[model samples]
Target chain A: GAGVSQSPRYKVAKRGQDVALRCDPISGHVSLFWYQQALGQGPEFLTYFQNEAQLDKSGLPSDRFFAERPEGSVSTLKIQRTQQEDSAVYLCASSRGATGPEQYFGPGTRLTVT
Target chain B: SQQGEEDPQALSIQEGENATMNCSYKTSINNLQWYRQNSGRGLVHLILIRSNEREKHSGRLRVTLDTSKKSSSLLITASRAADTASYFCATDGRRGSNYQLIWGAGTKLIIKP
Candidate 1:
């Protein structure tokens, strides 16, 4: 596609349920990132992937949040045992390079844990 | 926090007027970038100003960066109703992770048509 794309634009899950958000970045993008946005706050970094290497996962809130980009082009963010506090918009972005490059974001997946 | 802090959490302006938003950061940054988010969608990159550059322009958007004070400003000239959106300032630390860019709370801009 012309821009980054995310699947399941909106998802509602009960507490303790597991949910997965998918991100398909622009083809050939070398860098991918995952972020979580609360109601009115800015995006907070969750993790980052350079090609297929998961170089930065410090931003992930907890062990419940996991992300992977296996083939270097597509990524998935999985949340296990989702809590009410985990309800937020999951955003994915991709850049052409690993450092100091402009990131293109996707429409985001709004996960509501009821 | 190295993340930038944006002032005027909310802004309302009339069409054809100019809107300016300010952001301040704590530590040194390699570059500052501005992005626009409409409703529930994603953010679109507006402009980027490096630490060494004082100012830059793209269309009606003008961005100014002052590394000495660790501050930056984004000015939108002749605002239009379609320009209504939330604006954010993101900064990449000079010595942090390569892919991490801390973002501010953002300023919600409403352009009255």
Candidate 2:
């Protein structure tokens, strides 16, 4: 792909429903990141992956949030028992290398929990 | 918790006027970056300034970093209507830390044509 790609550009789920968002990072990129952005707010870091290794999950807000990068190229963020406050834009980004390369972002999936 | 804080939650300016935004951080940083987002979509990287560098420029974008004060500023010269977007500042802090980068709440810039 030319750039990072995310699935389900928009999703509306009822409260307590579970939802999954996917991300396809740039070809061969070694770093992947997930962020959450609420309305009228900046994106907040959710998790990070270095290749297939999930090196950082410290940013995950709670047990309801889980992210996985099985092969290091594609990742998924799953939210269980979604709440009204869970409604936000989920963003995925990738970087060329793990150290300090610039990050390229996907359009993001806007999740609306009603 | 957010590591960076940007000033001026929103700004309205006329076309062709220069727009400036500032960001401040609490901890030491390896580098700081500025990004722009339009209509709440994906963000586009504008410029990055390393701790060792005091200033950098790209096209009409100018970025400055003052490590002593843990702050940075972004200046856009001759801004246009197309430049209207939400600007945010991010920081890459100490290594071995999961929070590689912390983002600010962003400043919304509205350019009246």
Candidate 3:
């Protein structure tokens, strides 16, 4: 793709339900990142991947939050037993390198848990 | 915890006027980057300044970094209505030996035409 892309631009889940968001980064990009953004707030880092390796997952808010990039190009973020607090925009970004490079972001998925 | 803090939560100016935003951080960084996000859109990379470099320019965007003070500024010259967007600053640093970026809340810029 010309730029990073994400699936299901919007999602609405009932509290206690599970939701999955997907991201397809630019071709051959070596690094990918996931973030959660609240209304009128900046992105909050969730996790990072160098190729298929999950180098850092410290930012995941809780055990319910999980992300994986098994093939390195496409990634998925899964939230289990979603709560109303989980309502936010889920953003995915990719960079050409593993460190210190500008990242390209996707349009983002707005999740609303009711 | 977010390391970078952007000053002036919101800014409004007439078209053709220059706008500036500031960001401050608490720790050493390898580089700092500015990004712009229009309403309901994703962020686009604006410019980057390395820790060793004091300033950089790209088109109408001018970025300055003061490593000693751990602060950076982004100046947009001759702003246009299309320049209306939220601007954020991110610093590349380590969190307990893990490389990641700390982002500011962002400045909402409105260029009124």
- Model 3, span B20-110: residue lDDT tens: 9999989988889999999667999899888889999999999999999989999999999999999999887565222477789999999
lDDT of 2 by residue, B1-113 (tens): 78889988998999999999999988887778899999746898888888899999999999999999988999988989999999999887446242367889999999999
DockQ of each candidate, alpha-carbon based:
0.68, 0.56, 0.62
Let me know the DockQ for model 3: 0.62
Candidate 1 vs candidate 2: the TM-score winner is 1
- The residue-by-residue lDDT of candidate 2 on A1-108, one tens digit each, is 488999999999999999999999999999999999998888888888999888888889899999999987999999999999999999999988887446888999
- Interface quality of candidate 2 as DockQ: 0.56
| Residue B109, model 3, lDDT | 96
Superposed Cα deviation of residue A4, candidate 3 (Å)? 0.4
How many residue pairs in model 1 have overlapping backbones? 0
Model 3 stretches with alpha carbons more than 4 Å out? B96-99
Which digits, one per residue and each the tens of the lDDT, describe model 1 over residues B27-111?
Answer: 8877889999997668998998988899999999999998889999999999999999999999874465446889999999999
What's model 2's lDDT at A67?
95
Q: List the pairs of residues colliding in candidate 3.
A: none
